[model samples]
Target chain A: MTCTGLSAFPLTPIREDSVDERAFAAQVTRVAAAGVDSIAALGSTGVYPYLSRAERARVARVAVEHAGDVPVIVGVGALRTSHVLGHVDDATDAGASAVLLPAMSYHPLTDDDVVGLVETVAAHSPLPVIVYDNPGTTHVTFTPELYARVARVPGVASIKIPGVPTEPAAAREHVARIRGAVGESVTIGVSGDPFATAGLAAGCDAWYSVIAGTLPEVALRLARPALAGNAAEAEAENVRLAPLWRLFTEMGGSIRVIATIAELLGIAEQPCLPLPIRGLDGEQRRRVAAVLEALQIS
Target chain B: MTCTGLSAFPLTPIREDSVDERAFAAQVTRVAAAGVDSIAALGSTGVYPYLSRAERARVARVAVEHAGDVPVIVGVGALRTSHVLGHVDDATDAGASAVLLPAMSYHPLTDDDVVGLVETVAAHSPLPVIVYDNPGTTHVTFTPELYARVARVPGVASIKIPGVPTEPAAAREHVARIRGAVGESVTIGVSGDPFATAGLAAGCDAWYSVIAGTLPEVALRLARPALAGNAAEAEAENVRLAPLWRLFTEMGGSIRVIATIAELLGIAEQPCLPLPIRGLDGEQRRRVAAVLEALQIS
Candidate 1:
């Protein structure tokens, strides 16, 4: 089935040095309760690449078990196709309903490289694959032509477009272009929580989100208007979510912001970021608090 | 010990799905025989990230064993600092003289982040560290100020600058700036095979080379005059090496070109490039052969 509506990529909570399974499961259950369509474990927000294979597998297993009726979408992005195939197997073995595969590389990927990667990965994967396009993280951006090529791969169910450029014109144009290229055969979802409303207003089918993982109710409040074709209403809510979005932009990634949000919401502990990287400082945390307070999220 | 002179990053040969140890050892032995100053196993040319931890450890072990008196610099770059620390231990256990680290990230790193990462990794590492700057792959560039900061980190012994802009003027200025900033405590070397002569003439201490690994005689033919301060002679040789350099430029990376070079020299079989990535096609292979023929390297 095509992935649709809001899907939560819940933060993989770290208690001490381990994946806090109880906290992780609870986060999934909480988002699932808020009526998100799917729970994506080990997504960018989940820090999949930073975690060891065993840790990732456990995260997926717990995610699937706790998701209940909500489908579980595991991020299976890796540098090598063999490694990605291994992750695909892990997702299937963990009982995930779908897998999100980003074209991850430390090198520049040619068009044929990306197409070959997705097709080979989809061929081996039992679960439907959602091609994730987040050039900010992977340095591999997919044009509409590239998306169309990936969409035609067997077992590919959807594509998640990243929120980039920030300018409403570029964001809107990008979504429209992908929709036109892929047509109705592939589901179109928007990632980068800040641009969800703009993507939805531009006719995206789903929101692959970060905020929804913690503040699902608030995320739903923002998404519902856009999903229902009320562009004016969605844009208004996006204005309210502006402070939080600014924090994401400032941090250069969602990991620290989401972790701080969870800590504020009392859903998780201070994130145990993979070593050499620390969580947000007091100033950043204070800003996060102010944003949450401004939005009245608590 | 500072990394200096013509250090070779020999391609890790793949036989079936595994690192071909015998062929890998032979490659190292051959380069060392040609009198390269060091041997860097698992550098970009080695595809360290594409291999599993076990495979990397195996490659490191084999590289150290075959390197003889030549210093073996193992690439220990990883996404997480914790993973990097693990690799440090692996490098130490393998008996490598030093470890080469690129500021590997899926996200763009800030100045503080880069400094923090290198300091932490160096603190935990048993072997001395060489900071690798390859923006084409990592998307992280180190300014002279940043290199100075990294150089002060206790265990960091050197920095490897890449041949970017390809223009000799900017390349020379970049090397000079780093040298001015860091002083003599940290050795500065250059990578990108074609830029070795320019780098050496620009006052870099070494050429951390790709071509040196497979075509050591030719690589030395270029490096000797440059090392001896014969700029005119080195530039002439660089011009002679221009045809091969163009192939490297066309491919956007050195992996395929080096792999093709090894195959042409009968050092190894067609690389089994981690699946979904095919070797050079007939046209590319024909071009590689023509370049090698013109160079008149038996």
Candidate 2:
């Protein structure tokens, strides 16, 4: 089914070096209570790369278990196609509503390759498939032409494009172009913090929020004005949320943001960041705490 | 033991969807026969990523199996550190003299992180460890400072640096600086075609080859002059092998190059590239044939 409005993409918080099922369940309850349209688990904010096959399945199951009636989209991009197909099976088994796949591995891909990937995933997926375009991490941007090609594939239900400012204008242009190309058969969702409002205004069917994990109310409030086409109110809310956004997008990016939020909220005792992520310390932690207090979140 | 003098890095040709073990064996035999000092398996020219864990182990086995008394170093870089460690175990089990570990997966690593990785791998490895730096693929350059840090780590026997023209001046400078920093404790091997001569002349311990897999005799013949300090002769041979270098660097870069050369040499029947690598077709095939014929290997 088409997503009608903004969906809160909560960061999948890890605790004790494993999937924090208790924290995840609580977060989902909060998101549902806030009346967010949907919940996405295992996005980059979830630390998709560090997770193992078993952990990924567990996270998907926890999201679906706590989601109640809300749809859950599970991220299934792996370095190998076999791993991706395996995740599709696991997601289906875990009761995920859909799968969000990124064309991030094995270097840049051609349109034909993207089409092939979509078709392969769709053929095996029990749920609808969502194509994720996050070039910042993947280094491979899915152009409108490629999305149009992927849209034709059966089982593909949505497209999630990151709204980072560093991305070229062509990325946003592709949103409208892809929508027009695919008609209403496919839904469009926006990710990234800075351009969430502009992306919705530019014709994305829904907005995904990273901050929604900790500040569900803030996300809900911002979406109220943004979805209603009230630019002034939405812009003000965005500015208020900007500090948290900056913290999350710092050195560790999404990983740090998600972990810090989990710790502050008492959902997780400590950050379980895998190797490659040096946890926030000293000034960074102080700044994060100050920002959360300023926003009245902690 | 420290590796001194020149070594031939022969490309392992792929034909007909699988590694032509016999052809690879033949190539290895030829490299040994040509009086080459040493040989390596599963370098970029071996299409390491395309092969499954089992397949990679087999490639290492085949190379060592054929090398007899000649020292064989197997490239064992994968996305996961566990996989790298596993390959090191497999290579040693297969009787490889040493293991070449590429910092291919986690790029732009902090100095501490890099040091930790080297220490962990060295601790686990049964054979001597060679740190392979192919920053072109890894997106993380290893500076002299970083190399010095790694060198201090126990069991780091050598470093394999790409001699590619992507950063010719930087490549030369790094070789000089790294040599001065590490001194006799670590050997430095040069990779990439363009700067192989310059690297050797500047005191690189050895020249690693991708074309050697296809033309072992030619690679051995050329290295003799280079190792004898005849830069002019080595440059002429490098020019002759230029076409082969260009072919392998096409499409998927090093991965595609190995598969294509394997097919041309009748070692493997078809290209066994994993997902994301579309096998070479038409123009690429013609180019491979032309290059093989020019090199008098066909």
Candidate 3:
């Protein structure tokens, strides 16, 4: 149950705008079968905010059921404190090993507000908490000082930072600054799939990844070496994924591209993402399909 | 029901983490009694995203009931398209005259996503839609080109643009640009209290005032002249209330400061904001109180 390796975040596939439970179970089972460190369900990659309480609870249950012995971490996000507490309760009742909590701001949360959210959730949920920071989407960035404050809250086990600087030394310094702030207690997990290996080389403990959600082996190629402290090997793996990373950047975000990957590989049904977020199709779908072929990702 | 005068946005007062219906009714009645053109319930100042569907429906009904002859524009924002549709249905059933729809992006929505939201709502709801654009919070800035596209969508009756540029000529030109996009059909309502008079003077059709929600008379002192085409009188009033506007700038946003104004006046109970969004207290509280007195707001 250590938070120190690849934690796969699978797509919570939708069929007709509802959680495709059968497809979701298959997604989880595949990632578990591929031997991930843990299964982090309902992260942004899972489209957490779009799902209803009933849907989220059911998804969490499905994840726990099919994830075998993989420690299941569910993302608990809502605009209101009480509503977030409701999600934490649902995550707990569904038998999750830990809960991933984000500021999830509709209005940008003040530092005091974000800290208060952490304290409230930590106080109520008996499970370990991973503080999620994705400023691009959440619009609430955490200074390392703030991270120091949040990670110290009781039951907080990790900090899932957006991405570290790509340069080797700067990434190390960045991780070091956070290390000095949070010390040895909380794990530092890097998100942002492209920078995953570099962040690991910088001494991050885990990769809370998007790519690992569907294509675990491809992600594991970069992760295993970096987690094993072989920077050159990890960097080589990352260098080879330049094409896939380009696809993510070009598509505006990882969700649509990843969903396209899932659909092309038959991991999930077509139009898996919630409505309003279109999955890539036509020429774009062909482009992703070509990348999958060239990289031999499937 | 033309969207062309001062539209008040009252806070949805919260006590014990539940909607304070009595206080809300009082707030609505006070605005209605002041003869404002419309009462826009559950706009940003209303803490719209924090409330439940049932809470929003009840608040919409209360606003309609207490508004007397005034039109009640209910904000029906939710993350999913279907949930938003459900809110629209509730607003219709509650006898709301129109519904205000913000992209309400938890994930920053694409142009297609936002337009799809408008098209979907327009297809279903009988009431007109106001495209609420507050990019500082919503994080989805609509281009003038995007505005033209959204305006053309059937049932989009208004566009509540954020603050216009400060300089008089610049403000006029900015409003004129939006004017060109939305044209004569869709009303252009201005948000941002500090920018309200300037936007109105610059040819915006309405002033969506947060300050007016707590103190309708004070807002009318400026709105009345501006709506009547007396820009000089409106400018004089805006300059006179410069201190109040400064508080909003210094405090980051209008919600907390306005909530302080409401609570200090006993218009609502203390801790009116939903949990995690702490109301101004102690010295900050005193600053707002002193400003209210200096401006003779109550």
Candidate 4:
């Protein structure tokens, strides 16, 4: 499979308590129309863990329907191996091109455990599987050795690492190490700020943009310069987007960022997060609004 | 509520991917018959998070039934709040006197978030809730200030702080601080090896013990001296149990220690831990077995 240069991470918005299917579909349509390369459904930005089994399946179906021709990679993270495999079945049935699997939710996992997880999921998924290593959220990092082991698993085709600004250098090093270790066997993607130009330059094949859920144009514009090998232009766009990145990161990572942006974009009827995640306080909300206004997204 | 003396915690055994309910019941009966103070169901030693909703409920029911008059506190921890609340409901229905809640599960929580969680659960729970602060497993510590805030919640009646052997003096200081902050509103329980005696002397209301699970006779003997205000004898018992404690702590934390001991004592048919918790390896198993034999538990 040819590597996609960009993937829109469509955030799963919650209305009341259940999945907001209408809002999700609308977001998918907007992403596809904005010329995103592909779309990922039910990621951390989408509050994947909070969704019930049926909701996950329905969201995958809705996202695929809206994507039309663009590939939709559905996230398949559940505490149980059976649940994860079941999610893969649902995603594949919903016509998803691949599934993103995070290892053993809510537990500090070992390297062997991750290898076992990738092997188990790979055995079940009909399509290629993507190993998502979001240590900031999952608290389990996939070391380079573990990444190589996971890459060697049959049907495992990609790895996604979080690209926070605090660790841009580390992210670049990791991408380079993973690419060297796994060769062309699997694609390496970075998910975080739009400033993943450095990571993309260091060997990251794709950028997974949370902002793409709302402002696909900005995401596409930011990546265009980077993809075209214009580092100077990409850096300029990065500086322009820095305020938005800081706002989102300060609002407590991707879930809140996606929800807040979706609400601002006027597509989501409500910004509801599952228990344990509260909406941004008054000051934070105002700051986020100011940033969005400056970006002309609102 | 009158403060009970040092409570003995027994390990619940796992066999064939399920709680060895029969063995667990027998163990409970033996511990209670040995004149132990109380039985804690689903502590870290119980492999709490690994059990399914139905299995955890069953364990609580069986433990309460076999425990006779001893108060049983069940562990209620899940990635989702709904599941944790469900476990609370099941435990209360199964005659549990209180529930032990871990603050960290799906996401890393802040102090305010934990305070909110305790209040929310306390409002819903039928039984009094004990805030379990196991930083080793959860990677989040509930500071004394946070505990003080949570203590104001109506149904939060106790705090369980794990003790560290190397820093018994520091544990003692913490116990004093917590007791002073919360006053008589919340009972303080220490859950470590060396700190149990010091914690009690330092004003902790009760002591939570893991050695109590596998060797109730030895655990009771150790605590009997402590509870009777005989420090010298208690310290001697602590020395006797030290080797076993070292073995348990070496295999892993509370869960592995409890499971290993249960197997050695013939109370658990198999050392079955759910996915991601691989039991002791052959070398470690041999070492654990030898330690149990030396301690006369086998």
- Preferred candidate (lDDT higher): 3 or 4: 3
Pairs with steric clashes in candidate 1: none
**On residues B103-173, what C-alpha lDDT tens digit does candidate 1 reach at each position?**
98775677787898898888888888999999988889788899889998998899998884457787778
What is the DockQ (computed on Cα atoms) for candidate 1? Answer: 0.60
Better of 1 and 3 by TM-score: 3
Q: Model 3 residue B230 lDDT?
A: 95
RMSD of 4: 2.9
| Model 2 lDDT tens row, A59-98 | 8998888888888888898755666888989998998888
Model 3 lDDT tens row, B1-298: 6877999999999999999999999999999999899999999899998888889999999999999999999998877888899899999999999999988776667898889999999889899999899887778889999999999999999999999997999999999999999999999999999998889988999998998888999999999999999989989999999999999988878988999999999999998999888888689999999988898776
lDDT of 4 at A203: 62
Cα lDDT of model 4 by residue, A192-236, tens digit: 765477777666788877777678998888889877778678878
lDDT of each: 0.85, 0.72, 0.91, 0.75
Most TM-score-accurate candidate: 3
Task: Provide the TM-score, chain A, model 1.
Answer: 0.95
Interface RMSD of 4: 2.7
| TM-score for all models, in order of appearance | 0.96, 0.86, 0.99, 0.91
lDDT string for model 4 (B1-298, tens) is 3335656666656665556778888988988887766778887777676566788899999999998888888888765566678899999899988888887555456676677778878989988888888877766777778878988999988888877333557756666778777878788887876557666556666777777766777777777777777877877777777887677556545566566666666677664555555566788778888877787775
Model 4 residue B110 CA deviation (Å) reads 2.9
Clashes by residue pair, model 4: B10-B213, B11-B213
In model 4 chain B, the worst 10-residue window by lDDT is: B1-10
lDDT score at residue A148, model 4, on the 0-100 scale: 78
TM-score, structure 1 vs. true:
0.96
